[model samples]
Target chain A: MNWAFFGGLLSGTIMYGVPLLYTTLGEVIGQRAGMVNLGLEGILLIGASVGFAVSIETGNPWLGVGAAALAGALFNLVYAFLVATRRANQLASGLTVMFFGMGISAMVGRAYVGGGIAGLARYQVPGVAALPWVTRTMFNYDLLVYLAVPVAVLVWWVLYRTRWGLSLRAVGENPSAAFAAGRRISALKYQAALACGFLAGIAGAHLSVALARTWTEGMTGGRGFVAVALVIFSKWHPLRAIVGALLFGGAVTLQLQLQAMGAGVSPFLLNMIPYLLTLGVLLVWSGARRFAAPGALGRVYSGEE
Target chain B: MSAFTSPARRLRGACAAGVRVVRKGWAIAAARYAIVLAIALLAYAVVLLLAGKNPLQAYSDTFSFTLGSWYGFSEVVVRMIPLLLTAIAVALPSKLGLINVGGEGQLYMGAWLATWGAITFTGLPAAVFIPLLIVLGFVGGGVWAAVAGFFRARGLVNETITTLLMNYVSPLIVGFFVYGTWRSREVGASAFPQSAAFPEAARLPRFFDTRIHLGLVLALILLLLFWFVLEKTAWGLKMRAIGGNPEAARRLGVRLGLYIIVAMFVAGGIAGLAGMAEVSALHGRLRAGFSPGYGFTGFLISWLAGGSPLGILTMSFVLAVVFSAGSLLQITQGVPFAAVNVLMALILFVVLMKPRLLGRLS
Candidate 1:
């Protein structure tokens, strides 16, 4: 009710929202290229585990972020091979990649459970630091949080403004057409998968190195899925994803805040809100947007066919 | 010469031919599975090698622990119950081209409702209560899935996304009850978030001193029922038509929406039976987080099997062995239990890659 409470909620939203925005941006790019990496949860787990381990060992969070990104891109190649190269069913292939990610991340990160590190340094916005209502809460955040919105914009520019973007979209919309136009469809898909993995990895980095500051088993807790839903909510637009992620982030933060505030609702029921909300949003949005999904979204693309 | 043969002799000749055809079919299937499994195992061995573990040792230990003992074999059967039901859950709807990833959620809901029946109708006779639990479990899972199916049938949303999202939500709903209203208050067991133990009547009849229970019968019956309904019935033909071509089926006057909704409901109900079995026969109470992704595992099984009953049966047994081996591997291989997922995923990937060897050989 108070300004302080509202500011705290807003701040919490940014903290939670940044990673979601990153993942959503990545998904938007991949989906725009007509590939949906449903195994994103696995990618995030790989990134989180790798980032947390590397950060703890090196005593530098940025190195952890880089390692995570590299690991994610490399890990996603498995998915790229399956769905893009082998022309497997997208949904099934995505789920397998997810299972693989889960297993590999758990295997590698096993030694680092309960591990901690000096997290990413938070910075205050130089000018906005003096704002009256939001100064203390909203004006201070980690490096990733500050970069999140700009990254969305950058992704927007890359996907919407570049010729490469155009070709990627063409491949997604119609692989045959794109191939006829002289585009290497598989190559574009692999590139999209890499980019998606890279961003998803950073999103994982934010969860471990910058947010929770520790590694736990399956710590992402289905946030990868939340991001997937956010992609739909944003209509596959990176710019729109910023708002969508924040909204979903608020749903996540609200339950925690309410529990902390000694709200009467069971925390378990409250926890269901975000997922139910995603389902609701999907129900509402998916019905009307017959054209939103890329025509080749889940279709397998066999080369020269 | 055939024209001159007796009628009985000609009939016998035709029966022999049918038997030979069936045997040949079995040989081809066995060969295909053998190849898929060998490739999967080799890939997993490489993974083990990279992780600095002895691939040979891990495989041997997995074998001896899972297949080497009578008790181990029984446990595999027990594990197969849920895998079989859940796989059938996925397999049935897949016949109609619908993905029922909500098996996990439906399983939870089924368990939740069955728990209510178990706890509420304590005085009912065993025969009555058992059937009641079965009905409750089916309805619980069926209705939950029907919501998603309704959406898909209405063209409002894809069942895949709705079911996936609902998977996250259902567990939370179960948690609300288990940790709240349905919370067990047994002495010295308050720390556990679970329902009170079901009465004696609610417990499914078990086989010779093992966890294997009536759920096995239910699962077997349903698997047979699924095959029969899909292959022998008019309804099955309609569903197959829907799966093959929804637009064409619609033009031919098939009720696509009704079929979709009904298939999802039945599929969800089968998965619900999985939940009921797990809680009633295995745990004797509904516990939070009881399933370690049985629904997802079942989905993989159905996909790997390509929705064939025989394939589901074989894959579920294979996965059950893998599931049992996972815990043993954690101890012997110094790897985490989740490592099984890697192996399972490897198997799935191998099948998905669709190597030409099986095709050529078959």
Candidate 2:
């Protein structure tokens, strides 16, 4: 492939990867607090639709992002009540939330088909966007591309450096110990799940309004689930999750590029690459080392229990 | 004075305790069904009102369309065939505590494989080719499911995620063959992405003058087989034990991994058969949207029925009725097909939230 082709691949990969980065990072934070929100996909769908609608109505992308986050938080509230308070089965409840969110979003977004909203405009930092190759490859992109990196770093700092992170990790590892230390375990878990929802919502918004620039039914396109897979692949590390997202993004970009080239390969088989890669990664990772999940993950822990 | 007071006091205390327990149990069940029903009504009202029609009228139309005509009734049964098969796919693995969300993928794989088989062996006798195609479909689904099981058993990878991710992968594989390599030349239409039509020999026999076929009978047979295996056999006993308490079952000498794998295989095989039935009996070809979300709908039904085989049949027919009605609602009331989806989701949410709502009520 020529340099131009390689550059196109790089740009496409970054665009594709940004959404996964947001979601996986969000999941990393949630999992650190010992809560697995399988409803991440649901949140994404709601976010995408709501974000697209709001942005189109107001002509402000930031407003759309805020609305998307609120939608996600609202979805998470239902999940928080079920898994965190009532102690329903986490997986089942998560799946229910997913179905509900998907249905609701599709219904709500039916009118917004073919509508386009301006996405986050690319920021030109002093001479960065001016560079010949690097400009298009890196600096010339949507605001989400810029936000994804800092978000990853920020989450890492909160998880490892802050007292709140310590409390959250403690709650995940052993809620009893955290409760003994005067930490409100349930409160912390609720907060973490809500935060995860917000981030996931932003990811969804990025996909529809920012990236695709249009709203369509079921537009999240399994990216949210892919983010969950990335979390497992990254072993719940924020920075590593970003890397995993880029890897997946690269796979997606490759598929598109191959299609564009008319390489005689089936686009259908090419699309399967990322999922097959995820399964392969899980198998390989599990075989190499025992990835220690949060002890309280997916379990409803009452202080009494 | 002591004898009279003692007997009366005992009787009053007994009545109070009995009333409390009974009230609690009834409250729980009531909350569950009430939530589901309320959601269903709310969704219907919203859909009908938005379309500028009365909800009751829309619903009445739906019912009439589904039940009023022999033709419509046959169509409902035809729709129920795939739903029944997919429900069995979900219900089987669930017995072992494994959720096989990859049924959609498996269904596609089976349909794709069956189409390939049918087209390749076009001139064979119906008796020989038909059975071979069905078996091929079963193998296709079974092998796809077994891959997930292998990862779960040996790698300790979570089956839920693995199965879910596999779902995304499977459709693409099917699309690749239909769109790229196996695109029908005779039709010569890029807009219609579908495989070559299956041969006459591979086609399933119709049940009546309607499109309903032997697939419905096969679905009923599978339901009975599943019920017998789950309720009457040693394998059923082991599956329940594995699902209920895997660690305890393992200590008791149950081969946890083996049974899980087997359960998944059976689940996939049933799902595959559903796909084959759709291709052979209904559409006579594999096309995009051939499954028409039947796999996901089946998941909802299987879940609603709590994995009961008889319940699967009942729920499948109920869903089939709703679907038939929904399509009719679209034609008469201009309500979107998605309205039905909203209702289904609402019902599922109510079911999931029922216990807690009841607990609070009591």
Candidate 3:
């Protein structure tokens, strides 16, 4: 209601929403390329664990972020091998990848639990920093938060503008047709997988190295799933995903704020807000957005094989 | 009429025929399962070695604890009860090309409603109370899953996402009640977030002085019924038709929406029975987070078994052994319990790859 409350809510939204935004952006790429990585939760965990461990060992958060990104890309190759190469069912493959992620992350992160890092530094925009209310809410954040929107824009540009993007879209729209037109369907899918992994890993790193600033087992929770739902919410568009992620982020921030304020609602019930909102969003938009999905999305492409 | 055989001879002939059928296929199926297990274990052993633990010792410890003792073996059977029920929950819907991933949520709702019945009907006789709890559990889970089925039926949203998302919500709803009005009011128990203990009559009867309960019988009955309906009944034939080709089935006047809703409801109801059994027989009370991912494990079991009745039985037993071994490995290998997931995922990966080794026989 008041300025401080409103400002805090807005600031919290940026802090929490940024990670979801990055994940949504990553999944947007993968889904657009006709692959759906349900095992994204695992990807995020790998990034979070590897990022935190490297940061702790090297005492350089940037190195940790880099390591996390590479680890994620590498991990995704396993999923790509199963889904893209072996022609396994995508949903089952994704779930297996998720189980693998959960096991590996727990094993890898056991020693680093509760360990902290001098995480990404926050910066304030010079002019906006002077404003009374806006300064507190919008001007200051870690580098990832600042880059989140621009990256979404960049993703949109690449996905919509480039010739490579055109080939990729063609492949997703109709792999057989794309193959006839000389696009390498499997190769394009792999490229999309790599890009998706890199972004998802960065998203994980943001959780450990920037937001949480500490490592723990299962730290990413189900945010990966929320991002999956958000992709449908955004109608598979990068620009639209920015709004979807922020709305989810706002829902999360609102719940935490309400719980912290000692509102009469049980904290357990309050925790349901984001997930319920995801279901609600899907229910409302999925009927309309069914037409917006890539034609060959979630299907295993056999043309190249 | 002159060639008519005696009843005893006919019975013997039928038994021989059944044996011949099993002989024809089970060898290849058994070999495939054995190879899958070997590969999974080899991969998990490598992980153990990398983690600086002795792989041999971990395997030995797991087997010694789970397979070498009667009590441990019984525990596996106990674990398999819920896994079987939930697996059937998944396997049934899957027969119609529906992915019922909300087993966990359905299980919780079943337990929640069963608890209500147990607490309220405190003085009822065991004969009456047990069936009451069973019905309540079934209704709870059925309604929970039907919501998702309804959405899918109306073509509003995919059941996969709705069911998956709803899985996260159902537990919180249970938590809300368990932490608030349902909290055990007993002075010493207030610290724990669990409901009051069920009356003696509310609990499922156990067997052989072990934890194994009547849910095993219920699960076996349901599994047999599942096989019969799918293979013998016209309803099952309609469902298979729908799964094989929905368009053709629709043209034949099979109500796709009705089948979807009813199949989901029954599948969810089965999963609910698992929850009810766990609360009444295993824990004797409703506790927050009572299940350690039994519903999810059931999904994996159903998938690993390819949704066949006998396959469900075999896979549930195998995974139950793994579940039992998980705790032993934690202490002996100095690794977290989650390390079991690696083995599980590996098994699934091998199966999902659909290896050509058994291509001819399968």
User: How would you encode candidate 3's per-residue C-alpha lDDT over B134-162 as one tens digit per residue?
Assistant: 99999989999999999999998888878
Error of 1 at A35 (Å): 1.2
Question: Which tens-of-lDDT digit does each residue in A32-60 have in candidate 3?
Answer: 88988888988999999999999999998
DockQ of 2: 0.44
Per-residue lDDT, model 3, residue A31, is 92
lDDT of 1 at B15: 93
As a whole number from 0 to 100, the lDDT of residue B292 in candidate 1 is 84
Off by over 4 Å in 2: A129-137, A288-291, A302-305, B1-35, B43-54, B187-191, B251-253, B356-362
Q: Is the docking of candidate 3 incorrect, acceptable, medium or high quality?
A: medium
**Model 3 residue pairs with clashes:** none
Residues B1-362, candidate 1: write the lDDT tens digits.
Answer: 36999999999998999999999989988898888899999999999999999999988888887789888889999989999999999999988889888889999999989999999989998989999999999999999999999999999888988898889888888898899898889986678888988999899899989878999999999999999999999999999999999999999999899999999999999899899889998898889989988999999998888788988999999999999888888887779988899999988788778845345310
**Pairing residues by index, what is the TM-score of model 1?**
0.97
lDDT per residue (tens digit) for residues A1-305 in model 1: 68877777888888988888888888898899898888999999999999998998899999999999888888888888888888878888888888998899888888988888879988888887666666476778888898888898999899889999999999989999999999998899899999999999999998999999999888988888888888887888899899888887888888888998889999998888778877788777775576787888878877674
For every candidate in turn, the CA RMSD to the true structure comes to 1.9, 5.7, 2.7
lDDT of 1 at B102: 84
Each candidate: fraction of true contacts kept?
A: 0.78, 0.49, 0.73
